[model samples]
Target: MADLAHGKPGAGAALSGGHGAASRRDFLTIAGNAIAAVGAACVAWPFIDSMNPSADVLAAGAPVDIDLSHVQPGQQIVVLWRSRPIFIVNRTPDLLKTLQDTKDISLLSDPDSDVLQQPGYAKNWNRSIQPQYLVLVGICTHLGCIPSFMPQANSVSPGWLGGYFCPCHGSRYDLSGRVYSGVPAPYNLPVPPYRFVSKTVIRIGENPPDGGDFSLDSIEQI
Candidate 1:
């Protein structure tokens, strides 16, 4: 994997104290539209002849299906894949604009994604195959702790912008899961290999039909 072109100088220096972690009810309420499920029931295994996949296969990490139909713009939901938290967010038009802005990109540690933090298909500005949907591993890069989904702008700190915040270490990431320049995390959140099975369903753990030579294991981190 390629290293970050811009070396981190003041990493972890911008830690602030203001907001506490979001309550579970608040998270569910925010993601009310984003109903999701995990395991092989969500996948379509072309190679498998059996109608039912064995429990072992699912336990070993079979692709899961995510329903995007209910997810409204600007909302997000979390799903588990291979025992790792997967963040699926529906980005609004205005939110997408923020990601493309030069001013916002300049604040990221690996704005251009020179490093192999995600699949080639997800190396774009939105870090996803589809611009409206963002899929990322929820674990913080600094530590094994999970980051809270503080989507509202400045919810954690002043000028926070909307994104995930790691209360454990104060690491901040953009809505696209890109780590901030001055955070304790060294790399961006990892995007798992996945593709849209339909307009409303996404199959995680499988590469996109149009995407070539991409794999989750090839990422810099999980």
Candidate 2:
């Protein structure tokens, strides 16, 4: 999630660069904290002391839970899951429309998300389990640079419809992280296994309750 409402809110999430925790004592300390509102464009995630987790939380391969209740609509917050940057956005209704709009889809390389790398609930028009919240691995498929969250229309180029831009190679993606045709990126951004533990709390590095064997390793790229 990037610049929403064309303003930078300096968004922050609960854990920055945490690998995952093997024990609750290390990871559950901030279960009640909300993801601070972040906005504007070209998302830059500098660690904040209040939002950062302790070093022990970096233990690998356990579920990472985040409180997303305070993430304002249109705000995008980035958190590290298994040391991979995860983009979580509270997509507003208007943003949802852009994902569904044909005019916008026409510019994408994979509008239908037909790529097998996107399995489970992500292989759809919106590329998410729900229409409102979007979760994606925030690395550019072209060469692994973090794509800037430019949600403002025309923020990166003429006719831009609010999505991600990988400045490293000029690759573009839609709000749903679908790569654009003629861009250097070939596939949509990968969606990690995640599910809502509660209405506002999201658990990353694990699947939703109904999720069946949707392994992250099955996805060839991050």
- Per-prediction TM-score, please? 0.72, 0.72
Q: Residue 189 of model 2: what lDDT?
A: 93
Write candidate 2's Cα lDDT for 1-222 as tens digits: 321322445443323324654434334534433232243221445545536665666467577998998889999999988778999998999988888787777777888887755657777878888878899999998888999999998788788879999989999888888999998888889988888888889888778777776866787676
Candidate 1 RMSD computed on C-alpha atoms after optimal superposition onto the true structure: 25.2
lDDT of 1 by residue, 42-141 (tens): 4544446565646886677988999999998988889989888999999998888778778778899998788887888888889999899999989998
* Overall lDDT per candidate, in order of appearance: 0.82, 0.79
Name the runs in model 1 displaced over 4 angstroms: 1-59
- Quote the positional error of residue 7 for candidate 1 in Å: 67
lDDT of 2: 0.79
> Total backbone clashes of model 2?
6
Clashes of each: 0, 6
Q: How well does candidate 2 score on lDDT at residue 36?
A: 29
